[model samples]
Target chain A: MPEPMGFFTDTTVCIGCKACEVACKEWNQLPAENGGIRELSGDSYDNTRRLDGIHWRHVRFIEQFKGPYDGRWLMMSDVCKHCVQAGCLEVCPTGAIIRTEFDTVVIQSDVCNGCRACIAACPFGVIDINPVSGTAQKCTLCYDRLKVGLEPACSKACPTDSIQFGSIVELRTRAQKRVDQLKSQGVKAELYGADPNGALGGLNSFYLLVDQPEVYGLPRNPQLPTRNLAKSSSFSLASAAVLGVLALVGLRKRRMDDMGGPGAGGSN
Target chain B: MSDTFFSGAPHWAWLIILYFFVGGIAGGACFLAAVVDWFGGPEDRPVVRTGYSVAAWGAILSGALLTIDLGRPLRFWHMLFQSANVPALMFKGWSPISFGAWAILVFGLFAVLSALGGMAEEGRLHNPALRAVGGAVRGGLAKVVGGVAGLLGVFIAGYTGILLSVTNRPIWADSPWLGALFVASGASTGAAALILLAPGRGATEQSLARLSAFDTKALVVELLVLVLFVASLGSVNRVWIGFWGLVLLVGVVGLGIVAPLRLHLQRRPLASAAKLVLLGGFLLRVATILASEGIERYRVAAGM
Candidate 1:
């Protein structure tokens, strides 16, 4: 009914403000993190443990130092990829995980049976089960907000507009242009989850990375669980067939052995 | 053992390995039932009936374990009611979960019918309608239902491998052979479990021996594939060499494929050795998956 919407996260411009996180919590009514305590993570300013049921939008702070230059703080607001080939969607048994008309992945919380298949299937460790609700929870890309003709809360609240939201096609074009701009400025910025042929058939919400994806806790190659299923099923069937034949032969042999015995024959 | 641990592996990798372990157990149970049912012997019917019941229950339980690990457990139904995403690798055009659910339902129904049939034949149930239902189930109708349910079971069992292989993760994605590996592992474990569970008798012993031989053959194939996969990783992905090497040498050879083979060859009782092998196989899968996760993490870290 509407254009396919998605997120274009430009990691280079992210300031790690985490306003998006606050906005998401406010809009979605998610609970406070660690009872809203101000504790340092020792790793960075990212006190939030990680993406879980309560926290949908996470700003990752990666501290890096290159050559003799002063160390730089890389911040990227991360959310669900809304992958074109979502593993979570495939493995979910209850039909709770669904793709919206906007081509974004969303889980129907009401219908979910608290099966963690999607959590296991997700390559990025983005999804989690809500301990409180006993249901799988992740960023819905603000499906509820989208339905009312408004942008996602996180995108709207981003101070630097790091988490951009718009049509996937338009976003891709904008992302490519941003990458080109970064390259012109001698920055080695590349797009992760951009190539459709790449792992997971690209993501509806892709990223602009200054370094490798793993530095941002992204998997280099995210496989689909179903691919392995087809191959294993065929082999299993063939093995079973072979076993079945052997069993039949064994049955025939047993029958013959019974017939050969003196007490085997009886009046019908 | 310290060297075997891959520091880069995340929590999800461990979770997947657990998933595979449970899935294999469930699938193997069903396979064992099928083999026993097809091959007649003393107590074969009882063995077959028990195997099916265990498998049915085991599958549901394993599925539950997987569901418990999800972030949106309440949204589990979206996999069935929502529009299927054909292009997505994980998209079950018709939810495999739904298929598995139906399979369990059918198998449970069949088990009840068969049990009622036994009761009717034994003069426990005198009602004519009950007898009729039992008779209908034992007739041609049972075969059709069993066939459909069996087919569904196989799919559910095999789908786990496909789910892993479709990812671009090099350690897993490199092998177009994972599916076969999963199937072989499932069957081997299934047969071994049945052997261990079935009552001891000369006929049952002989049946177990045959099943063991079949399992051995499947294990050999799995071993070969693991070797080939590790060897290929030497050139395909250098990091995988170390990670998968440990997995192959320790996890698969030492634990899964070989250790049980050794036990069986030593003339140990079927129950002990079969259980050992099944445990080993489950460990091997978990270790391999975790190793793959580590390698992937390393690749990402190194910007490869």
Candidate 2:
């Protein structure tokens, strides 16, 4: 629906401006949540720090040093990936978290029980509970704007077109061209979360990275928690089965004592 | 190399820890009682009564803890009956929390009924009608209810572990062994609860010995599960092994299992060890939840 809206965040051109963050807060009508005041993070201009309950769009500042003087500041504007198999959607008990018509994940505040299940389930750590609303909140990919045939506020406000919003298909074509162009220019450019075959079935909001994905604080291999369900469930069953055996041992020992045996269980 | 130490975990917080503790302990107690009622015979009524009462109370406590901790405390009905729900007996999806709620609620109800079945033995229900209520729940009915409650109790014990394992956090998702660890710990709590609340007042030396022996077995299970859980985490990160691991080792494994085993072997008063195990239970839950700090707490990372 709606041509599978998505965001192609080209961190290569990002200028570390707070415009995306500001636009997100302004458009979503989110309250000031960075310690309830305009306080600096002391970790450079990354004052908002992370994607959280309030701040959906975060500009990550990764200052890397190769030597005493050789260093580079890698700035990337990060947002929810809106994964195809979103862990948050999979774990939300109340079904409050749903993939939108545009294939972006959105949490329904009214239906959210605020058990914070999604908070942990989200591999991206994008979803958080609004303190005031008492519900899980995350980037909606500007669901309202998408409905009205407009772009997300963050992309609209991005001065350098670093954050582009449009059909995922179109964005992928553009992102691939950019990656190849940068690679030809000797930039060590790479694509992250772009493949539809990876664990998450790919991200609607993919990224174009200049360095390794891990260098940007992104997981080298992100996966849904459900992947371990079979293994984990099996372990639990094994545990319960062991406990059941112990319960048998307990009952048997008691029976022996009752029948006037030597009380073997008394020692062990 | 990543510069930040952000752990993308959950914000389960204190209330949830408390809920897990209560739910585990309660489920354990109920399960223990159900076991006794179904199979322990007439001589084991005291332990059965104690077990049922503890389970009933535990179920009630957990239910309250969860509801009050919820963001939308009033809309519990949404969890119980929505398009997603199948009414009171509803269970859909891998939402272990919702399933746990159903298990605890149902287990609590059965536990209460089972506990009431013990009322006739306490005397003073001379009002023929009231006595009949108690009498009806006795005998075959008690066995059926106890059997069901016991099974639910076991589920309750392991449900929290399953819930945590399903999350993407490595400390939690690292192993399925958490389920085993929880069930074992829960059963230990059940024995400990019975030892604390109803310490065999007219219990035969034989019956007391039996309970103690069974508790030792429960401790054995607990220690084994802990070992399995730790083994699964094997060399991930020492940050957790340093603090939460220490808590699991000392607070749970040492205090919970070793102390009780020693106390039981010496034929000494087990109240101290039982109390220690109870305390260890709460500490274990708290430490695990707090351990999520580096991963999912107030930190920043590249992406999920």
- Say which candidate scores most in lDDT: 2
Question: lDDT values of the candidates?
Answer: 0.65, 0.77
Q: What is the TM-score of chain A in candidate 1?
A: 0.87
User: Docking quality tier of candidate 1?
Assistant: acceptable
Clashes of 2: 8
**Number of the top DockQ candidate:** 2
Best by TM-score: 2
Taking the tens digit of each residue's C-alpha lDDT, what string does model 1 give over A1-268? 7877899999988988889999998998887655768577565577774676777888887778776687888888888899998977876766678899988999887767665556656777677666667677889999888998899999999888889999988999999999999999999999988777787888989999998766777766666656555554465466556544544555565566657764443211
TM-score of each: 0.74, 0.92
What candidate 2 gets wrong by more than 4 Å, as runs, is: A34-36, A67-69, A256-268, B1-7, B83-90, B124-133, B200-202, B241-245, B294-304
Model 2 per-residue lDDT tens digits across residues A1-268: 3567899999989999879999999999999864577877675767776788788898988888799899998989989999998988887777788888899999888778788888777776677778878888889999999888889999999999999998888999999999999989989888888888875999999999988776676777777767667776687777777767666667776677668688754433
DockQ of 2: 0.53
True contacts kept of 1: 0.34
